[model samples]
Target: EAGVAQSPRYKIIEKRQSVAFWCNPISGHATLYWYQQILGQGPKLLIQFQNNGVVDDSQLPKDRFSAERLKGVDSTLKIQPAKLEDSAVYLCASTGTSGVHEQYFGPGTRLTVT
Candidate 1:
């Protein structure tokens, strides 16, 4: 099966600018997640989708970050008016949810804001 795919391994941006990232999860997976991982820290959940429906987005910054999974296959995450503190690796993962936390992650999109 095709693994998850992401783009722009790294990105440099200034505060108050906007940026977006893309992700394509594995096939036949039922759950997809987007996480923000700060340097040397564990990945923090930003949003989660169960199939085509959104399961959770509690940690997502509504003021700037937004995402969508219209077809339940590929997803996109966007951050507008970026902040310096937003510098982190954005990882996309997927799991079938047939068992407990069985998730596969993408390489991630790293963002650096100045």
Candidate 2:
């Protein structure tokens, strides 16, 4: 009974550099989500994946941000030419299939772009 997994729990880079984050959702969980959370603000949904297919990404900044769920399990999020305003916590969460689907969040990757 393990939870979601994310790597490189912290990252720092200069503006204009690129950064990537990884996530592995729980077994059998069909829905996965990536969220961006700025300090003092609630997390904003960046993208969502149901299995290996994308469900939503309208809020994501296409020019600088991208994400994918591979094989319906593992996922990655990348930000290119990072901006100083992109400094925030990137969180990965997953949920089950039941009606009362509870979402589990990973220890976010905090990105600091100088």
Per-candidate alpha-carbon RMSD to the true structure: 1.2, 0.8
Count of clashing residue pairs in every prediction: 0, 0
Q: Residues 7-54, candidate 2, lDDT per residue (tens digit)?
A: 889999999999999998888898999999999999999999999899
The candidate scoring highest on lDDT is 2
Residues 1-97 of candidate 1 have per-residue lDDT tens digits of 8888998789999999999999989988889999999999999999999988999998998999999999988899999999999999999999985
lDDT at residue 35 of model 1 (Cα atoms): 98
Quote the lDDT for 96 in model 1: 82
Worst 10 residues of 2 by lDDT: 95-104
For residue 106, model 1's alpha carbon misses the true position, in angstroms, by 0.3
Q: After superposition, how far is residue 66 of candidate 2 from its true place, in Å?
A: 0.6
Clashing pairs in 1: none
